[model samples]
Target: MRILLLGAYGFIGLAVARRLQQAGHDIVGFGRDLDLGQRLAPDLTWTGTDLSRLSSEASWQPYLDGIDAVVNAAGALQDGARDQLAASQQRAISALIAACEARGIRTFIQISVPGADPAAKIAFLRTKGEADSALQRSALDWIILKPGLVIGANAYGGTALLRMIAAFPLVQVLAFGKSRVQTVAVDDLADAVDACLAGEVPKRATFDLLAAEPHTLRDLILKLRRWLGLPTPTATFDLPAPMASGLARLADLAGWFGWRSPLRSSALDILSRGIVGDPTPWREATGRDLVELDVLLSRLPSTRQERIFARSQLVLPGLVLTLASFWLLSGLIGLWQWREAVAILPPSISHGLAASFVILGSLADIAIGIGFLFRRWLIRAALAAIAVSLVYLAAGTVLAPSLWGDPLGPLVKILPATALAVAVMAIAEER
Candidate 1:
């Protein structure tokens, strides 16, 4: 089969594309970042396509040509600076379905969630439900596979959140700890999709692809901790619902700046409601049960790299925010006490030159801080911070070498800040 795989660069999509390719299918990958998709899977052809822009049947027609099947693995948690929920999930899906029908491409596989409903309070689920309905009503051989919290070897989305929680040292802190969640291994999901394409599963049917039993969110976290070879927590702190919601709202606000924090309100709402679905339909059809969470974890690689990734994700947000605040406040304070700032320079430099230098440096600091706050500019911000820190260190050495020996150690402090900027740049790449 020649398959057009949407979101082929994403966590799940990439896994599925590999599975289909291993099964001897020609895969054409579609994603907003064609460069990333190509880099991830160089063997496959890739097209830079944004589903949010494919809001009409005509817009989707060109992609359907010579396509034997279409697997939609793209999705967004909520509307953000880079995401449009209704447009991407609902309108684009409807348009694609219509185009598929017109182009005589009958096989369409939709990857959805467990409790998607058009009338659901959460926009993510509602949009998914609307798209699922549109596909059901169309004249194509559609298969809806709604997987529960997907557990994959690669950490992303809910999986990333789980790893972050598990990485906490000695004490476990949680929100919605008791919410029940069923999980499907990423490999199982890929296999199920392959089964659908192979006509091993029923056509035009909805199947919940998950393990037979469910685990509480707390249990899942502990399992992940064990998987990562982390020590057991000495204590557990289950945050109150109100506090959890407050944090989620803050994360939601961060979304506007293009940070796709997993703790956003949409994610919280779904997790609190519980992630579950009947796995019997898929099992009955395929005569194979999905692996249990423990088994899934055991089968996956548990190496130093995995542990580093989990711990890095847990510390990343705090690190970024702290760095931004440090730079921002430093600049603000420099501007607020212009005379004091100028006085820090040696008597050899004139007052006018000192004042001008202070102003320019503060403005540069402010720019770096502002850049750090925006996700799109994070890498550039880190780079700028490092460059400016070097410049500051060199200038301080030249103008006020005595400050290096002072108790405050102003010049000494720049070393750690510059090192931090390097660290942020190292781990900033989302993919």
Candidate 2:
């Protein structure tokens, strides 16, 4: 079957594209990010066009010609103004439906978020709800697949959650962590899409897809921490509804004023309400058990070695040059001063201190560079680098503030070195 897949570069889109390709289906992708699409499926025929730009029905008619089906997977989870999100959805999905109808495109599969309330004020969820409603009213044979938070190997959902847990060892549990969700693997969701396209499922049907096991937010975090070999995060505290709502409102206001909120207010609200649904429809239709959270978490590549290697490669050359340059420059300056009969003792004393400083700093840099280069020594190297950088900054600020700038400047200068060390250490320790 010839399929036109919108948002074919996204987490779910890539999974679907791979599955369809394996099943011998030809795919043409329409996405804004050509590089991402190419990386996901190099062989896929891609059209780099923003769906929002194709406002008129005639503009989208060509994309529908000879296309067996249209999968509307293109939408934003973040990074948009409230009005823009709503407008983009209406323009893109509405245009696609009208064009598909005009060109005789048969199957229209609209991917939407599970448990999105039509009355919700969150722009993302509300837009999805509106798009689903629009598809329902369209004349084309459509299947609406409302999937729960998707999880997959190398995908954003699970990986992002893991990263968050890694960054923050203590997280606020929402109202004693009673809010629950069921996350589905991207591969399983893709399989359902393929089955629908194959006419194995009834038409004009809407199904909520989720994993077999439902987990509370706290449980999910703990599972992720264990998978990443990190200590289980302690629940910091829970905020009451009224307080949580106030914080959410404050975040929304901050966002409106161009301040990026670390957490999404909508996500918090969704979590509070528990965005779970009945898994009966998915289980009955797919005839497969949903993937467990542990299974999905297990698939992430142990990135410790890779990160160490990457940091080492970046730091090694610069460190080597820094050492060589400092040594040569110091000697040249010493020799020039000696010939001029400038007091060698006082100068020698200063030069000796400087040389000691340079040697120690260089050794630390080299150790860090080497540690980053070899995954095994990452932890030791990181600690050595951090210790050396802190000491060097402190001494430099005291002795030669002019050369090192203020205390903060020295700290800033050593940040890249510190980062390289930390990355190496994290990877090495994990390995």
Candidate 3:
């Protein structure tokens, strides 16, 4: 089957795309970044489609051509000027439904979430409910999956936030941490989509894809901590709702720095409401029991690689910013204090060499700093940064040996810089 998988670079969409490909289906991916889709899923065809502009079927036609079925796994938790949930999750999805109907495509799968209702207090749930409702009203055959707390190896959004919280040395829980929640593995959720595509599940049905057992949010965090090989949080903070929301706003402000923190105000609102769901429909659809949370976590890569990826979600960004600071600061110093920057040059080197080292090297640092900000080339930039760090170490050692004994240990700092570069490279590795 030819499948058009939107959000193909996303956590769930990537898993489903892989599953569908393994099942011998040709896939065309639709997402915001085609470059990211290619790097993440090299074998799958991908196209960049701005869903906000897809106000009607005509806007979706270019993507729906030669597509036999469609899977919409794209969604958002918060609204920014650039990425509004109403467009990405609701309105554009309705447009895609219309296009699919026009193309005579009968099969569609929507990756939704629990507590999706038009009357919901949270905007995320309201938008998702609206989208799900639109799909149900469509004449095309549709399967809506409402999964609760999707757990995946590649952390993003809620999953990423969970891993980060789990990776912390200390455990922290909200005062209302007992809020009931269910978790489903990414593979399991993707498999549910595959089941729909393969005709192994009931047609035109909505199902909650979740584990057999549900746990309190606190218990879930503890389980995740154990999964990450961390001791149970000795000191857990029972954060009040108002306090947590305030902290979430701070995290939201950091979003301007390029990391979308999942602990949004709406996240707390929904968490307070709980995320449990019925699993009987899931059992009936797959003709098998859903994987329990314990089993699901056990199968994940808990060793070095997985742990690095999980912990480095926050670490990598900090490292990149730190790296950027060093480069940009160095550039500013060279441009502002060219005399002092040049004085570090060896006595044997020509004045010309010293001038080139000051100006050209500073410009290189600034350029590398700018490159680090782009996600598409982050890995490559990290690699370049590693090389640059090494070059700086070797050059400083040869040219400014006396500076090594300086109070700040400027030369000694290269060791951590190199390590940070290597770490970012490892984290950003596409594989």
**Top-scoring candidate (lDDT):** 1
List runs of model 1 lying over 4 Å from the truth.
347-350
By TM-score, the candidates rank as 1, 3, 2
For model 3, how does the per-residue alpha-carbon lDDT over 205-313 read when each residue is reduced to its tens digit?
A: 8998788788988788778878888766778876876888787786665444444557776676777778889999878657767788999888988877667666777
- Give TM per candidate: 0.97, 0.67, 0.81
- Clashes (backbone N, CA, C under 3 Å), per candidate, total 0, 1, 0
Q: What clash pairs does model 2 have?
A: 304-427
For each candidate in the order shown, give its overall lDDT on alpha carbons: 0.91, 0.65, 0.81
> TM-score winner among the candidates?
1
| Comparing 1 and 3 on lDDT, the stronger one | 1
**Candidate 3 clash pair list:** none
Sorted on lDDT, best first, the list reads 1, 3, 2
RMSD (Å) per prediction: 1.3, 11.1, 3.8
Give the least accurate 10-residue stretch of model 2, judged by summed lDDT. 339-348
